[model samples]
Target: MEKISNFLEQSRMKDYILKTKLGESSLSTVWKAEHRTTGEAVALKQIPVAKLTRHLKNCLECEITFLSSVNHPNIIRLLNFFECEGCIILVMEFCAGGNLASYIRRRGRVQECMAKRFMQQLGAGLKVLKQNHVIHRDLKPENILLSCSECNPILKIADFGLSRILLPDESAETVCGSPLYMAPEILQFQRYDEKVDMWSVGAILFELLNGYPPFHGRTSVQLLQNIKESTSLPFSHLVLPELHPECMDLCSRLLSINPDDRLSFEDFYQHNFLRT
Candidate 1:
């Protein structure tokens, strides 16, 4: 506790002034803050120490450890972190345009050109994560944010609490992630590698074009069953008719039931859909 107090004192000297509460979840609360000296805005995530279970503690440590070593334009940057008596504070790069989930909710489906641009940026970020041997277990619209509210805003990937650093031959079997965007392998409790993230990318791309997930169910059991039994994307004719055939093809490949058949990040970037 004494060490925590000292750390808080030192952090206060750095002059981060909290402005407004940005968002909150069961484990943490995020705030929009600014550096008093430089006036640079940042997102501050506060995780209460008292409420952390063993699993949550591990997640917190994993997120901080991995984020500190990564530096990429399309990935959210963790600038600083502090541990206080009651909570852990992480100062992260602020994205004024907010997350993709809200952006989609407001505009419904995004235009093809804009969706392509965002997908390209997201793919770039995933490439970096792959090079670093990290797998983002949870990849969804809510985990993606815009750098600014503009016609061609830079898309940044955020939320690494469920991420894991894998070895050359390692695969994760943890059935953890948002059910809506989870890969079929993950939902079926099968061993999955970084390819799971690609499946999620497909789900996001589908939602960006259609305003809803490819698979849906009234209950978790039903959702899992739907994902396991699903063989193809149930594309709406109204939306599909307007989108390029190449785009639809790419989505289908990415969301393939078999992980081995799913498009690799490199292939996705080079796909005709993105090229067009």
Candidate 2:
């Protein structure tokens, strides 16, 4: 295609070299690339414009627009972006420590102190998103990455494909996100707000402590029903009696079935679990 040819020509002029494939999704492919002149290592997420539907295009635009507007230590940075060859390339910060999901798999379960540290950073990032009127519909370990391989690596939130900018009076209605992490409102098709993210945080915290999600189901229907009906913390059942009571309390408040009763960011930061 002419577009691809022009992209190649332009890439030669820019002196950007694609070194290795990092990852791929249905809508995009990511590669590790370098700036020939500056010798900077950057992650390049390339989306084939030719293959994108209108919805996918909107998703790409949303990610670029939101990421470019926000800057936080715990949120992944979007350095630069360009379009070429019927594709859009997003240059991003390179995180060498990989995703939190893989980190959890390697370690089984995270210690309380480490989980608290990571949650604090994640909370800070979420606070920024709240202030900016943006909602990250999908918040899971896979979307959280480490800055480097260190004794205590800084966590950075990534993958904004399912995120959305909320209007002052609007509540999102679309059901999205991983089933186990979905809030009750989302599963029941009720209009929901940023509180859905809090629910996800609770799920993440549970998994970090127990090495698995709080809710499990053999089928999708059963999962939704379980989420709807289950509202109490099963500390004894999960064999996590050693966990701090304050921690369990915070988790309960976060995963509240009623959004209004869920812990606010201000309260979350002041909670005894984090304070200790």
Candidate 3:
């Protein structure tokens, strides 16, 4: 709470009281705060406008614009935002269950039914992105949040730092996203379409089912090489017999190195893995 009082006191945004630091990066800090009148919990992300790079500023604008326009249970909501001094603050809903990464870390490999439910929710969120012509260049377990610690919690997609709008036929040439979850086309510096997001979803699904990422490397080149060489998903023997065939099929399709063959968001959302 004391960490953010100076900033809050300086601004007109004195209606909220910062309680704890949620996260921090070189460019911004996130704090969990409570509204003074309503006692509602919220996440406040503070970024210094003076220190923002061109790319970061663009990402901030995109995040604000995209979040403000859409409303979905699987997508993080923007409560309010205000600028003060040299900083830009974004107010968002506070997710109590932390992120999917922490969820997976604590539980290890999840049950088949649970993994399927997660994928379905992620797909539902992607539908919103597709409708808005947006590409969430960064999609990983760390960016996906849980609404609660209940037996069945809602998954909300968060962090639009690397997102951008891309039309149906358009492709993005940017080389960004986490190495482990990034598509081979992106790592190879090839222009890619929305299918790149599917690759990320595949990596998330792989981690959920097997408790590890599909590929690992010291560098991007090595990772690309690993993906190129692997003829099929390297499922652990322990789970090989336990996992459903449809689940494995969907995961393999999403991880396809060739974007041309990768499942589109439409096909992915309606995949048999989710249907069954």
Candidate 4:
């Protein structure tokens, strides 16, 4: 709390020197920065306040509200934030290990044990989301981050721009999230609930094990068609023989095309695939 207070009093755009350009999107740019006084390393996210629409502002507010209220190891930490110049600057703890998208690209497919570990961490983070009734409309390898580069990296969930609070009993109609990771219901413009997030988690877990997404499309329509026509998840033939039956079952349950048949948060978190 005291740390945040000091930032409130002393924050300036010039207080930190931006080093590396970490990531970028239409909404914001992330940079690796070093504070002048303490030389503390942090990820600086700059959003142009002047350019924000009402909906975008609401999204930012939702993200800040959720991140500030939670303190979980699997979720990225928002240290401090302040308005400066024409931008709303967010200071977040630096994750030296980069993001899961890059990791998966470089490694192709990881061993089953490593994939299980990553899935377990993802489940831990999703547990927090379920408890809060927040739907992370976007959940993909790019949004999932790593903690360090030298040793095994700890997974951290990031990028909550498309997230919204939706009670378990209610549903949302917003059609958002990356197409490959998005649930089929979302693709078909149907109302969706927390189960959409389950579909995304399944896509991520599938990619972690197979080095590619479960489904693909050149466009949204094509993707929806492929999803509708698909019979089963395309697991790598070489990797299938070595995978545990529980692992296969969990993935199948998560990626179920029918929302009613999808794994609920409790069932997914308690699945046997993660027991090891």
Candidates' C-alpha lDDT:
0.86, 0.83, 0.90, 0.90
Error of 1 at 188 (Å): 1.9
Q: Summarize candidate 3's per-residue lDDT along 131-160 as a digit string, tens digits.
A: 998999889999999999888999999989
TM-score of 3: 0.94
Instruction: Give per-residue CA lDDT, model 2, range 1-276, as digits (tens).
Output: 977878775775376788999788777888888889999888888888888777667666788988999888899999988777667888899888888888889887887778889889998888888787888888999889899888889999998888888866688887778888888888888999888888999989988887778887886678877877775765445447667788888888988888999987678878889888
How do the residues 81-170 of candidate 1 rate in per-residue lDDT, one tens digit apiece? Answer: 886547788989999999999899989888888888888899889888888888888899998988988777789999887887877789
lDDT of 4 by residue, 1-276 (tens): 977755664567678999999999888999999998899999999998877888778778888999999999999999988886668888898998999999989989888899899999999999998888888989999999999975589999998888888875899897888999999999999998999999999999899899999988899999999988888889999889989999999999999999999999899999988986
Candidate scoring better on lDDT of 2 and 4 = 4
* TM-score-sorted candidate list, best first: 4, 3, 1, 2
Worst 10 residues of 2 by lDDT: 231-240
| Model 2 spans > 4 angstroms off | 1-9, 12-14, 234-239
Residue 183, candidate 3: alpha-carbon lDDT: 92
Tell me how far candidate 2 lies from the true structure as C-alpha RMSD in angstroms. 2.8
Which is the better candidate, 1 or 2, if ranked by TM-score?
Answer: 1
Off by over 4 Å in 1: 1-14, 228-231
* Lowest-sum lDDT 10-residue window in model 1: 7-16
Clashes, model 4: 0
Clash count, candidate 1: 0
